[model samples]
Target chain A: MKKRAQEVERALDVLLPLPEGPEKRLIEAMRYAVLGGGKRLRGFLVMEVASLFSVAPACAARVAASVEMLHAYSLVHDDLPAMDDDDLRRGQPSCHKAFDEATAILAGDALLTRAFEVLVDVDTHSDSQARCELVAALGAASGARGMVGGQMIDMLSEGQDLSGAEVTRLQALKTGRLIQYSAEAGAILGRAPSHQRHLIAAFGRDLGAAFQIADDILDTEGTAEEIGKTAGKDEAAGKATMVSIMGLEQARAHASMLAEQAANYLSSFGEKAANLVALTDFVVSRRS
Target chain B: MKKRAQEVERALDVLLPLPEGPEKRLIEAMRYAVLGGGKRLRGFLVMEVASLFSVAPACAARVAASVEMLHAYSLVHDDLPAMDDDDLRRGQPSCHKAFDEATAILAGDALLTRAFEVLVDVDTHSDSQARCELVAALGAASGARGMVGGQMIDMLSEGQDLSGAEVTRLQALKTGRLIQYSAEAGAILGRAPSHQRHLIAAFGRDLGAAFQIADDILDTEGTAEEIGKTAGKDEAAGKATMVSIMGLEQARAHASMLAEQAANYLSSFGEKAANLVALTDFVVSRRS
Candidate 1:
């Protein structure tokens, strides 16, 4: 994960350099939000899933980078004062806090557009069909039917009681779809068989669900020092989450079961799936 | 123009229906921002340019709708309190005013993502290569290097003195590139020859410049009722523009000259370019 994160960082640095103009702040905010970032778990998923098919590292890296860009754009917008109003992200000032709201908004917009630009570029894949497929999947994962829809629900549901099923659907769209795309993208890149692609996508779906449950768990149980950003936010906001509906112990148990199921979904590949299996375990175990 | 605008409105209505769920707000804001207004100049450019090559109207309409989606997203963001802070758009409340700020932001984000989604879909073009090319072109025109970059400059240069050349470069990136893409998209859809594509793109470049200049003139001379939004905003914001840099008379002359130059770029196409030629004239003459 560390190595893959570094590779993604380098790729982003190359992909988004500071232009020699006043608009340099846009690139700066984009880099600030994207680089020196999160666990790069999404990028790791793409690379590991692709590695199962021995997909070219460079090709996988670009795909990984594109997902990371999309993820970062989401984070930027999620932190906006009008959104979650976050001031810190990954223990640093959020993009809006680091560079004013307008620049952050534009930076997020640019990064989102850049993600598709990177995906469609010939450098990412030689086949235009593969490129278009990636573009289509990312759109499906991130647009209104997916992440954006999930976010809208998250906002509207605040302080409102939500059942476990509703929250599950919310989390599934909000973050799971992107995570699923991240995991399944490598198969598309490698032209893995449809059965293999479905297996990988299923693993991603379970893992992503577990990942969100873990996040809720951390938000409920961890401190700011451990989790970064403000902890206890979900509860304070009366946000409905796995932890809120299922309780901590049940959520923890559910996450453990999901992690195991996620790993089992990858079992078809046998030993080649070791890294992914471990990553699944890591998702539930993560503190931040 | 009215006919083309109506087609775009219908296309958007079909493209962005209010889904049953909490996300309906996001779609509401998207529809409210996109439908029922605007000159549809970009869509007109697209259809007219495509018509020159005898491209199918359905295919061209989709491309036009995609470009308009992008334009609407930009307008939504630009009206944010953190950005331009305008309360009015197209004679109606801005997205943030009509819907709360968070919904507006997500709506804009969704629209931007939707633009690429629309372009990459197979319905837009049977050839994956053509769809990918459209995706790439839209990204190039609207991402950090284009509209977003221009917006960044606009924000940074606010309240600061900017030369005429700097303002031109800013406008070119901000609006010119998308207009260029709007004109060039039909070529991509029809797989026009390289020389032909360049000709259309150049015409778009000149027309886009003239279009921005017309916007500045409208801001300077028209009333809010006449222009459908707050007029004289440029001078009020102390925003640097062609009109500010070149004076009203010179700016008008420059725009007139550009309309001619833009039309001349299509001279090779002769009678086939009649719609495009008239559209350039309409761009400069439109009040809203």
Candidate 2:
């Protein structure tokens, strides 16, 4: 997983070189927001899933980098004063804090646009069909009905009582879709069979649920240094989460169950998906 | 032109119907920001250029609507308090004014994502290559080195002295690239020959230059009622513009010259490009 993260970090550097223009600051902000940060869990998922199909590492790295770019854009925008207003991310100042709010916003916008641009490039996939599918799938995962829509629900549900089902649906849309897309991307690139793709997608969905619940737990228990950002922010903001609705112990139990279920979906792949299975365990039990 | 605008409006409505969910408000903000507004110059450019190659109207309309969606997204984000801070757009309250800042930002992000989504759909083009080309071109035009880059420069250059050349480069990145893409989109959709595509791109480039100068002139001369938004906000914000630097008369003369030059680039198409040539004149002369 660390190796895959390093490869994705290098890929991101190549994809987002600083240009010689007035917009260099924007590019710099984008690089700062994305490069050398995060657990790269999504990147690792893309590479691992692609490896199951024996896909080219370079191609997988490109997709992984694109996902990271999209994720970074989301984080940059989410930290804006109008949104979560986070001042720190990954142990450093957030994009809006590092740069001015306007630059941060433009950086996020440009990063999102660049993510699509990278996916559609010929280098990402020789086949135009695969490239188009990547663009379409990413759009579907990140657009109104997916990540962005999930964010909308998150913002609206703040300080409001939400049932467990409502919270699950919200988390599924907000973050699960992108994580699901990260896993399904390998299937699309490798032209995996429909049934196999469905299995991988299900694996991603369950894994994402487990990941979010674990995140909620971390927010509840981890420190600022351990988590790399503000801890207990969800509780402070009155944001609805599984931990908020079900108590810490119940949430942790549910996350563990979901993680195990996520790993079981890869049973058909046998030893080929061992690392992915291990990842499921890591997501639920990791300290950070 | 009005007919094409209406067609594009209908296409947008079809592409972005509100869903029954918590995110419905986000979609509503997106719809409100895009529908029944603007001169639809970019949409008309796509249709007219597509008509020159006898492309299907349905296909052309889809591309037109996508361009408008992208344009609308830029407008929504640009109007945010952190950016341009305008409360009015197209004679109505802007997205942030009507809804909220967070919703407006998400709506802009979703609109941009949806624009690419629509482009990649099979309904937009039967050939995946064409859809990929559209995606790549739009991404190139709107990404960091394109419209978003231009916005970054615009923000950084506010209240700063800039040379005429610097200002031209800024505007070219900010607005010209997207306008160029809109005209070139028809060629991409129609699968025009490379030479023909280049010609259309050149025409669009010059036309966009003319259109921006005219807009600067409008900001200098017209009222909010005439222009459908705050007219003199540019000068008020101390924003760098051609009219601010070159003065009204020289700017008008330059715009007219560019319009003529833009029309001449479409000379190879002869009468088939009459409407496009007429558009160059209309853009420079229109009050709004």
Candidate 3:
């Protein structure tokens, strides 16, 4: 919707078709899955962080591309019949709905595998160690203890009462981990020290928590038309969402608190963190 | 299994569990998918190549473990009902049959993502440039243009007439790419030069093709009991295979010929390649 968002969108348009051959059709399907409009929040975070340090525009674009692929993968599987079972994503038929279920499965697999391919073969990033760190961060966040684990917990807790802390832990793993990696991955490539890494990761954690809480609030407070996909699906599934456990008012306040915490982390970076600052606000108040 | 195979197997034995925790179940499932029995060819390739250049044992084995994880993910997805529809794999019910379809899908996803994590986290390898090369090779082989593209072609070509060249191209991408990767990946980690790298890859190409030809022969010639899975399901599915395109006798001759080509590549390495030599013969003759 915004200019930077437009830039990320255009960048993806060109990068997604880089591979050729029998992969041509499948890669087309995968690129469509990614370019199928979203907030592009994760890609924004990567580009914003890179812009802060004046890192080369081209290298930053590569990181933005990598994170988007990871995000696309999460969405595809999350909407699968066995997982969240939604029929729509980003205002159109979901991947599994648009494509066959098996194709959707393979599409997600292809995207996830291809993300690392972008990093390893990156002609622009000559620093292999930095590239390796980015790969590790991305992998850890998406692996067993990250998004997939969070999904499993989400599934298991559907009919059970989970404690507030349990819900946060699960949400952090499922949503926060990748968000954390988004920022950390950018910083790793930029050669941030240990403390700077922690600082950025802290920002991602708070931003992700606020993002999820805002989602919970929107699920209860927003209309289905406004949200694009199914709203209140969490309640229908008996999910232990913030809105369900703590009520709408508390969830809204909690998310606001997390948003402010996210902004606080960027204070160390000064005016250069303008995009990051706007991002925290976007995380808290966006409808979709 | 021999001693080193047992060593890698033992690491896998302990690596598969996560105890009782938020991420435990998903992690356990991923471990179970890999820990199941199969020929240790991929792992052996990593270790043997690492051994050739005297890389540390853990460095070599870590890459081996990641290769096994990727290999296992392929097996899991290939056995799904929409794919090959095979009921058994490696003498056990397929992951989908043993676990639910959803778990099998996620297990494959987790394993694929975790392979890159293992690559980055392990500290035994010394060459930053070479490590990146290793990562590139693995990603190329595992992603759409290599394994997944080949898989898509494999799926699309079902019930179609195929020529010998088409079958070779399919098999080269689907099977040979990763096997070629297994050898080159290890040699890269050991800091082998471009020429040396080319040699190992050449060896892998010949050996992997030989192995696949033997597999075609097995489909026509071996019993299910000996192969540990369904035999000749390819022809029943009306998918053109090497044995179908060329007669079984010709297929057997092709396999033996490929094995000789594989052996020829290894003569450059002198006697240090004994295990690789033995492995070539082993691959051609393997019943299971």
Task: Give each model a TM-score.
Answer: 0.99, 0.98, 0.96
lDDT score, residue B277, model 2? 87
Ranking by TM-score: 1, 2, 3
Could you give candidate 1's per-residue lDDT for residues B169-191 as a string of tens digits? 99999989999999999888878
Model 2 Cα lDDT, one tens digit per residue, A86-187: 998999999989988998888999989988988888364458888899899999999999999999999999999999999999999999999999999988
lDDT of 1 by residue, A160-246 (tens): 999999999999999999999999998888889999999999999999999999999999999988887889999999899999898
> Which DockQ values do the candidates obtain, in the order shown?
0.92, 0.92, 0.71
Q: How many angstroms is residue A287 displaced in model 1 relative to the true structure, after the best TM-score fit?
A: 1.7
DockQ of 1: 0.92
Considering only N, C-alpha and C atoms within 3 Å, which residue pairs clash in candidate 3? none
RMSD of each: 1.1, 1.1, 1.8
Candidate 1 residue B86 C-alpha distance from true site, Å: 0.2
lDDT of 1 at B60: 85
Against the correct fold, how does model 3 do in TM-score?
0.96
Clashes of each: 0, 0, 0
Q: Which 10-residue window in model 3 chain A sums to the lowest lDDT? A: A15-24
C-alpha lDDT score of every prediction, in listed order: 0.91, 0.92, 0.82
DockQ: the better of candidates 1 and 2 = 1
